[model samples]
Target: MDNSLAELDARVSGCRACPRLVDWREEVARTKRAAFADWTYWGRPVPGFGPPDASLLVIGLAPAAHGGNRTGRMFTGDRSGDVLYAALHEVGLASQPTSLSVDDGLTLYGVRVTSPVHCAPPDNKPTPWERDTCRPWLVTELKLLRPTLRAVVVLGAFGWQAALPAFAEAGWTVPRPRPAFSHGARIALESPTNNPLELFGCFHVSQRNTFTRRLTPEMLRNVLRTAAEAAGLPTRPYAG
Candidate 1:
């Protein structure tokens, strides 16, 4: 992580603003999944990971209860992560296709992954109020990344919805009428002093979607490659 990102990560990790989230995340950690009974869970908020100077940002929904909550990293230790990281690897954004743990030696070249709600919510859904409360962190993080942040690939409608407001809060000129989210949704937000920020939408990489083929690796990788290219990154993504 970059120095500024490290500072933000530290603060995000220690956040306990939402009492309900705090209680629930800790309770899940305490219970421990049967398969991960011997593993120590990262019950606290999972901070966003990636370099601060990244040009592309990947915003997800919250961490998975057993996946990220267990592995202490976004999209790690879960079926969803398996699909996501594989697509990222194929697109040349990630160093490896597997992100099973925080120390897994996986590095993102020009992308950062984060979320609207940092904590793992019950039923994988965070209440609207909770979403609003956590908006400041996203807004601040965006402020820091404004220099190089060029594109944002939102994993789902939830991420799309959450990000629009943060961009507006960070003083970007948002479109008057918000664009609706779709599998291949795309929009551009203009900034007064910085380059325009492109936003792309894709279905969430959840088991519900992947298992049913609602979201395939091809679909996700296409969007990722497009976003990476739009950000001026190399486009020679591997087929692996």
Candidate 2:
């Protein structure tokens, strides 16, 4: 097992374990989106973004074909990111409200953002096989984060499902008959060999949810504030 997050991330970024994901990501990169025609796509797997010692971790489903796959940074250059980052900023977990590019000067404070499937999938849905194949990366990441990690906010059911097993593998004992996912759900987990951790669920920041008000900015900020507090991190009051 890699002892450092940097080494684990380097290995993750170059992974080609899932051929379907590999082909799809590369194809999208080559056939660049019209709006991002001048951009050089970071077609490889998108690694987690934030400091290694983060106490709070936010897990998403996967990278968007034109978002992370284009920018090489998870959640960057996408509508989902706009909602997520803005909420994080409002809750004082992020330094800024925007995440346009990797160099956009946006920094996550005491939080890290990652996804189960690093590469972008076709139609924004990764296959079960691909998610399983990509599981070890998350497991390793969780283990690497064990020292200071305390709370996790899983966005959407897919991420919620993916995260539980990884948490188990990383030393947190998941309850029997695994917990069902629901927005605003919070579960406390204990580990004999590791620190106790809290898990939270929220609706994804996808456009469908945001446009319909299924996940309003205030709703997202509520979850972040609760999670950040649970993780022992201080959060600023919502400026708005």
Candidate 3:
């Protein structure tokens, strides 16, 4: 791990940006202690997953109840991660079929995934203060990863909103009418260095979305395929 990432990991492991959230998450973990007794409660913040030199960054809203909160890796040990890793594998971004745990031997080839709020908020909803406190980490990560970043795929509206300001700070203007969060909408912007950073918006692959057929595997795969294409990477067909 790079020094920056190491610093981020340390910060996340001891974050107390929001005392209410901290208390709430700990309470939830304690109540479910019997179920997850063996699990280590990060109980602080959650950091990004995958290599530091990745070309793609996947931004999500926050950690899930039993997913990232328990597993300590963003998008791990959850239903949403199941669909996400599957799509990542199909798009040649990940080296594994699924992400169930931190030590699952999963690896992202050219991509990384992270959430704006690292800790699991009560009811999966983070407060504005918590989001504000955590925004700097995302900005720092973007700056560190900018050299290699070619595309950023936001999982939902929250992710899009949190990430857009950073792009603007980097001198990227938002396009007219704005880019909406559909399954396959694409937005293009130039970084301060004049490198193009393609932004693709997709509905989150949450249980609510997938189980309700709001976002299907095919639709998610198509968004990733388009992102890969925009980044000048060859797209692979979805195996399923």
- CA-lDDT, candidates in order: 0.90, 0.94, 0.79
lDDT of 3 by residue, 6-42 (tens): 6776777788778877887777666665667787765
Please provide the root mean square deviation of candidate 1 (C-alpha atoms, Å): 1.8
Candidate 3 or 2, higher TM-score: 2
Ranking of all predicted structures according to TM-score, beginning with the best and ending with the worst = 2, 1, 3
**Model 2, which residues run further than 4 Å from truth?**
none
| Candidate 1 per-residue lDDT over residues 152-196, each given as its tens digit | 899888888998999998878888788889999888889878678
Off by over 4 Å in 1: 1-3, 237-240
- The lDDT ranking, best first, is 2, 1, 3
Error of 2 at 199 (Å): 0.3
TM-score of 3: 0.91
- Residue 112 lDDT in candidate 2: 97
